[model samples]
Target chain A: SQELEQSPQSLIVQEGKNLTINCTSSKTLYGLYWYKQKYGEGLIFLMMLQKGGEEKSHEKITAKLDEKKQQSSLHITASQPSHAGIYLCGADWTGATNKLIFGTGTLLAVQP
Target chain B: GAGVSQSPSNKVTEKGKDVELRCDPISGHTALYWYRQSLGQGLEFLIYFQGNSAPDKSGLPSDRFSAERTGGSVSTLTIQRTQQEDSAVYLCASRPDSNEKLFFGSGTQLSVL
Candidate 1:
């Protein structure tokens, strides 16, 4: 089984502060996905990176897949209270038949 | 529905009882998935259905857990003789295919007591 480790299990930042979360996998990732969730709510899809050295950004949030495809990072700029939520990194387990293996998750709290 | 929909937003069942959770994927979607989320843990992959065929089911924890997708649309995850450890949120998701973005349901909070 492939394992994904995320750093800083939880974080708290004041509004307008920038922050970053990292996701590292035990194996090379074929596809990396990002999702955000509010407590007790469904995960909201953010972005997907399929190629090495790929980078995608949505609004203030940006995600990048490393050249080795074994790590990824999510960066938020000028964060706002609305950015408070749990962020999860998922990977297409390569030969695992399309089921995404997910990381433990990072909880973000933004104070205004 | 606009997105994946799961039934019984919350369920409280006694230990050893059988329970079935439902998932209704978005129309026209050929891929549906079931995942379990325990408190403070990541989303655990449970099962995947692609066009009525389950090419992967290794994520199922035990024989007590089984899921079925019918007509390539709706899916049901049943836990036979549920245990206290089964207490968690059951989430359903769907995507266009293995390479696309996934949309998830709010999930059903299951409490086995």
Candidate 2:
């Protein structure tokens, strides 16, 4: 079985500051996904990374997967109050099954 | 129709009662999944349905939990003799066969009293 561990379980940052959240897996990652969830709401898809050393950005948010494929990071530039929520990283372990294993999640609080 | 939809946005049930949660995936999606999210915790995979058959159900926590999909469109998750530990938000997701991205529903918040 594989597990994902996220660093900085909870973080509080100023609205204009920058921050980074990391997700590490015990095994090599085949497919990695990032999602955001508001309180008591469903998750919204953010980005997905497949190949190792891959990087993708949406607006001010950027995500990178390491060459080893065992670690990934999400970076937010000029954070906003709207970025305050739980960010989760999900991994596709088997590739065939749509079942994704998720990390405990990082709670981000961007103070205005 | 546009995205995954779950029924009974909130459910409050007493112990020893049975409850069923429904999920309606996006039209034409062949892959559907069910996950549980406890308070302050990550999502836990419960089951996956490919079309009308379930190829993986190993994530189910107990025998008391069961789910079924019919006609490759709708899914229902049933919990028998619900326990307090069963309280959580059940989320449903669906994706097309061509991609790995999953579209999620608002989820059903279940409170077992």
Best by DockQ: 1
Give me the TM-scores for chain A across all models, comma-separated: 0.95, 0.93
Q: What's the true lDDT of residue B110 in model 1?
A: 99
What fnat does each of the candidate structures reach?
0.83, 0.78
- TM-score per prediction, in order, is 0.94, 0.95
The CAPRI quality class of candidate 1 comes to medium
List the DockQ of the predictions in order: 0.75, 0.67
Write model 1 residue lDDT over A1-112, tens digit each, in one string. Answer: 2389987799999999999999999888899999999876778889999999999999999999999999999999999999999999998857767777788899999999
Q: For residues B1-113, could you state the per-residue lDDT of candidate 2 as single tens digits?
A: 87899999999999999999999999999988899999998889899888756458988999999999988889999999999999999999988862488899999999999
What value does the lDDT take at residue B99 in candidate 2?
A: 42
Enumerate the chain B TM-scores of all models.
0.96, 0.96
Candidate 1 Cα outliers beyond 4 Å, as residue runs? none
The deviation in Å at residue B95 for candidate 1 is: 0.9
CA lDDT, every prediction? 0.90, 0.90
